[model samples]
Structures are given as structure tokens and as C-alpha cells.
Target chain A: MERIPILKLHDLLLVTIQVDMHDRLAMTLQDDLMHQIRRTRARGVLIDISALDLVDSFIGRLIGEIASMARVMDAETVLVGMQPAVAITLVELGLSLGGVRTALNVERGMQLLREGSPEEEASGHASIDH
Target chain B: MPASTIERLQVACEEDLVRVRQRVRTMAAEIGLSLVNQTKIVTAASELARNMLKYGGGGETEFERVERNGLIGLQLTFRDSGPGIENIEMAMTDGYTTGGGMGLGLSGSKRLVNDFAIQSAPGQGTTVTVIRWK
Candidate 1:
């Protein structure tokens, strides 16, 4: 089986998961990713899902949970490069990411992370500064 | 034989998921969907089957072939006599799962298919229908 690759860049973590698209693997990876986020105290995370062909409810929930856990650890989680079909399917299923952020690609996600600080957003400074 | 047919599948908790997967896969393939679409349908069925076993108190799944606008499609209905959802709106909301379900099961399954519907009332059981077109 192909492994999901995790790469650390600057203060962001990039995870390139192979398209196993299996619920069990997705859940396990979600757990592992959460652990990594907590351990590294990273500021941002970009999950590349361009390779996945399918994502069910279980995997979607795992992603949502990862986002929530990342938030508690003061990290921002961004899902990037989701296929159009996958996006449509996720919407049709009525699955929402709660507050997890999403971007079209990793570059955009990283840019978003760099542009804003947790204090600026949390303290309402960015909103006011803009 | 009619162009479309509906068959009632037995419910046996988690064991029923295997049957649901097999039946949905066969139906999805028969409709000429691509491998990706087939996988989506199978995943949807698995999620629903697990839900049926976990919350719906185990019921029946109905598989049918449908045609609309000259296109062939696969339709599935899951019905259970378990405790019905007290709040359909809340139940459909993401992150509002009462059971251990990842809370994405219903919504995610809805996304995988072309048409989705859910009907439930407290003490009246629950029914979910999903359709996929080729």
C-alpha cells in the first residue's frame, strides 16, 4: 500500500495522502495527523486530497475532527485541491466542515496562513485592520 | 422484466453492510458508472448500512433501478423501525450526530448521489432514499 506522505515547510505542515480512499485508513491518518499537529505546534496544515477518488462520511467526519483538534492546538487546517466531483458529492451529502478552512491549492492556503496571525484574527485586529 | 425493479434486502446489523455493499456495487456497475462513481455509491451504501444497524435498529434496504429523462439510475431506500429522529433538521446538520457516527454519514452519503431524501418522526421510524444516475 502507498503511504501518506507528511512534509513540514516553514511553520506549515503539508500532508500528501495517497488515494487509498478507505475509511479505516482515513481515520487512522486523521489520528496520526492530529498527533503530529499537537507535537509540532505547527501554525498551519494543508491536506492535499487531489489524489483521492472517493471520500465517505467517515473520512469526512475525520477531517472535520482533525480541523477541530487543530484549532484547539492553535493550528489552522486547510483542505486543498479537492476534485470538483468530490466537492459536489460532499455538498450533496450535506457534509459541512464546521469551521475548517478550505483553499483551491496549497499555495493559497499557505498564503492565507502567512497573511494572518492568530492574535490578529482572535483579537479582531485583522478584521479591524482591514 | 420491467426496466426497473425493487428488492427488499434483509437487515442483520453490521453483517447487513456486506450485502448492501455487494448489491450497491452490482447495481452501480449495471448502470455503467465509472469506477469512481461505483466506489462512491458503495461507500454511501456502507455508511447507510452502518447507520441502520447502529441507530435504526436494523431494517430493510430496498434496491431499485430507475429511469428519468431517458437516463438509467440506481435508487436505494433504507428503512428502520428504530427510535425515530426527534429533530430531522438537527440530525441532518453536520457535527450533530447523537450516536457515535462521525456525523458526516448522512450528509456525506447525500453528496455521493444525485438525489437524496430523508423522512422521520419520533416513534415513527426513519427512511432514507438515495439515487445515482448514469
Candidate 2:
């Protein structure tokens, strides 16, 4: 079985999708990411899709699902590095990726995660202690 | 005007959908389509191909380089032999799906391309043809 490697960077889980993914691969990634978030207690996930030139409805739905799932799991997901062409097409395809956070690049996405991380605030300290 | 055949491939599974997208992108680029146009056509191809696989039990896709007057464009035709759609109008409606999907395949793909056409009956198969001009 093929899998997309998920890397833990400090308090964030990073996934860069470089290959053209099949339906099964996308579903697997969604499941695996949720497991990793629970296992590592990661606060944020950054999915870089810079290499992908096309994002159809299926892939678009999966990304939205992953983001929503991470939210329910107490994690933030920031999709990063979407090409301009893909952006244009996705909107026309009638999938605006509502309720999903997006960043121009990885650096900005990481910055967003850091700012939004629950561990940064004093109130968050109480939750981390549990 | 008569269209020139670019390529044709079978869409039998998930892997074939990926191949269809890649080949459509390559063919779109070869015809000097802009980046946005190329992306739009490829995305449309992906949606239609997947629809054929899930609803039509897989099918065939044909690509063509079409010229109407002085404008050049790319056209795709998806044909599948499965339980055909009974009501295309309802099927094309957004958020309407028989399969467990987002239901953006038909309506959304139509928005992504310039021209869209569909032919299907109760027992017969379905054929979708779309074109995006550069």
C-alpha cells in the first residue's frame, strides 16, 4: 500500500502533496492525518499542494473534509501553496473551500498556525496540563 | 469545422482518472492554452471522468483539437456503458447525487468548460462532450 508521509515539525504536522493522487490515496491521507493528530497531539496541520496543477471536485471535497475533521479533533489545518491557475479553476468549479484556512505559502501557513496555536496563550496552559 | 484527434484512453478506475487529467493538461498545453484555461479543462476532465467511473462503471475518453473559425480549443468526450441517468436535469442540479459524492461533477464541470452536452437514456449509456476554447 502506498501512503503519503506525514512529518511532525515541532507542534505541527506537515504534508506536501506532490503526486497526482487517486481517490483511495486522498481518503487514506485524511484517515492517516487524523490518526497522526491524535497520536502526536499536534495543534496544526499544513498541507502544501504547490506541485498539484489540478484540484477536481473530489480532491477539493477531501481537503475540505480534512480541514473540518482536524477542527473537530482540536487541530488547525492551513492549506498552502495553491497555484494561481488552480485557484481560478477551483472557484469556477463551484468549490470555494469554505470553512478552510488557506495561505500563500508554507512560511505564511506556519506563521498562521503559530499565531493560532492554543499553546501560545496563558489559558491554553491549563488544557495542555491534562 | 472538423476536429483533429489528439488522443483517446480508457477510464476504467481511479488510476485512469489521474491519467486522464494528466493527458488533458498535456494536450491543453500543447495547443497553447493559457495556464488558467489549461487548469480549467483538466479540472473539468477530472470531474467528468470520475463521474463516468462511479456512475457509469467506467468508460472511454476522447480528446480532440478543434478549430472554429480562427479560434482553437480542446474538446473531450466521455462515454460509459452502465445504468444511465434517468433525469439529466435533476442530475445536473448542484448538490444532487445518487452516489455518495459532493454532486459537483456535472454542474461544476459545465461551469469550468465553454460548451457542455450530454446524451443518456434509461437503459442506454451516457455520453458527455465538452469544449474549452483558447
Candidate 3:
């Protein structure tokens, strides 16, 4: 079973989707992400989809679910680097991803996570207390 | 002087879905389609393939490079030999779904292509064909 690598950058967790995703991999990433969020007690999650060229309803729903799950577990999710064509097709497919925030790239996503987190007001560390 | 080639694939499970998408991307790129065009067709393929897996239990997909009326096109046909859709009009409805899906599979795939057609009967099977031009 291939797992999506999760990188922890201080208080933000980043998962860049570099491979073309399948249903199982998508589901696995969802589970792994949830566990990492709770274990790390992170303040934000950044999912970079720059490498993903195609996204369907299942993958789209998985993404939305990740955002919702992360929110429930006390974190904000920012999705970045969606391709123009993927964006167009997703809108037509009726998956709005209302729960997740959008960013242009990973750098911007990192900035958003840092600024959006409530813990950012403190010692630059979004610990379990927040 | 190049000859049109066709590729066939099975869309039965999760892995198949990914393979079909990858195959479509390669085929579309080979046809000299733009990035946006390639992505559109691949996304549409994913939706239709999932529909076939969920509703029809499994299906076959065919890809062929076509040239019609001076338009170079990539066409895909998905066929399922399972419980066929009785009402395509209702199935094509934006919010209508037989399975636990958004019901955008058929309609969305239709919108992403230059040409679309479907043939099915209650007991026969379902065949959805779509073409995107480059």
C-alpha cells in the first residue's frame, strides 16, 4: 500500500500529491492525514496538487473530506496548485470544495497556513494548546 | 503518413480507473492536444469510468485517434454489460444519481467533449461514446 508522504513544517503539515492518484491511494491519504493531524496537533494542512493533472468526483470528494476532517481535528486546510483545466472540470462536475481554502502555490499556501492559524499570534509554534 | 491506432482497456476497479486516466492522457498528448484539452478528456474519462464501475459493475473502454472533417480528435467509448440505464434523460439530470455519486458522470463527460453519444436498453447494456478534438 503506497502512502502519501506528509511533511511537517513546524505547525503546518504539507502533503504534495505528485503521482496520479487512484481511489485506494486517495482513501489511504485521507486516513494517514487524519492520524498525522491528531498526532502532530498541527494548526494547518497544505495539500499541493500541482502534480495532479486530473481530478474526478471521487478524488474531489476525498479532498473536501480531508479539509472537513482536518477542521474537525483542529486544523485549516489550504489546497494549492490545481491546474486550470482541473479547476474548470471540477466546477462543471459540481464539486465546490467549500471547506478548503485555495492558494496559488506551496509558498503561498505556507504563508496562508502560518497567518491563518490562531497559534500564529503566539511564539510561532502551534502546539497542542491551540 | 500516419495511421490511426486504437487502444482498449478494462475499467473494473480502482487501479483500472487510474490506468485509464493515464492512458487517456498519453493518447491525448500523442494527438497533440493542448494541456487543457488533455486534462478535460482525462477528467471526463475518470468520471465515466467510475460510473461504469459503480453502476454497471465493470466495463471496457476504447480509445482511438480520429480525423473527421479536418478535425483531429480523441474519442473514447465506455461499454458496460450490466443493469442498463432505463432513462438516459433522467440520468443526465444534474442531481440525479442511482449510486452514491454526484450524478455528474454522464452529463459532465458530455460537456467536456466535442461530440457525445449513448446507446443502451433496459436489459441490453450501456455504451457511452465521447470525442474531443485537437
Best TM-score among the predictions, by candidate number: 2
On lDDT, the candidate that comes out on top is 2
lDDT of 3 by residue, A1-130 (tens): 6888999988789999999888888899999999999898888999999988888888888898899889888788999999898998788767778878999999898777766656555765544333
Question: Every model's DockQ, to 2 decimals?
Answer: 0.23, 0.89, 0.66
lDDT of 3 by residue, B24-45 (tens): 9999999899988898899899
What candidate 3 gets wrong by more than 4 Å, as runs, is A117-130, B1-3
Per-prediction TM-score, please? 0.64, 0.94, 0.92
- Evaluated at residue B38, the lDDT of candidate 3 is 91
- Which DockQ-derived CAPRI band holds candidate 3? medium
Residue-level lDDT of model 2, residues B44-117, one tens digit each, is 99999999999899999999999988999999999999889999999999999989999999999999999999
Query: Can you rank all candidates by DockQ, best first?
Result: 2, 3, 1
For A1-130, candidate 1 gives per-residue lDDT tens digits of 4346678786678998665444445666777777778777677888988777555676677788888888888787898888776666666666666677888888898777766676766775332222
The stretch of ten residues in a row with the least summed lDDT in candidate 3 chain B is B1-10
lDDT of 2 at A26: 93
Cα lDDT over the full model 1: 0.77
lDDT of each: 0.77, 0.92, 0.87
Best model per DockQ: 2
RMSD, one per candidate, in order: 6.4, 2.6, 2.7
**Which stretches of candidate 1 lie above 4 Å from their native place?**
A1-5, A20-24, A118-130, B1-30, B33-46, B56-71, B77-97, B100-129
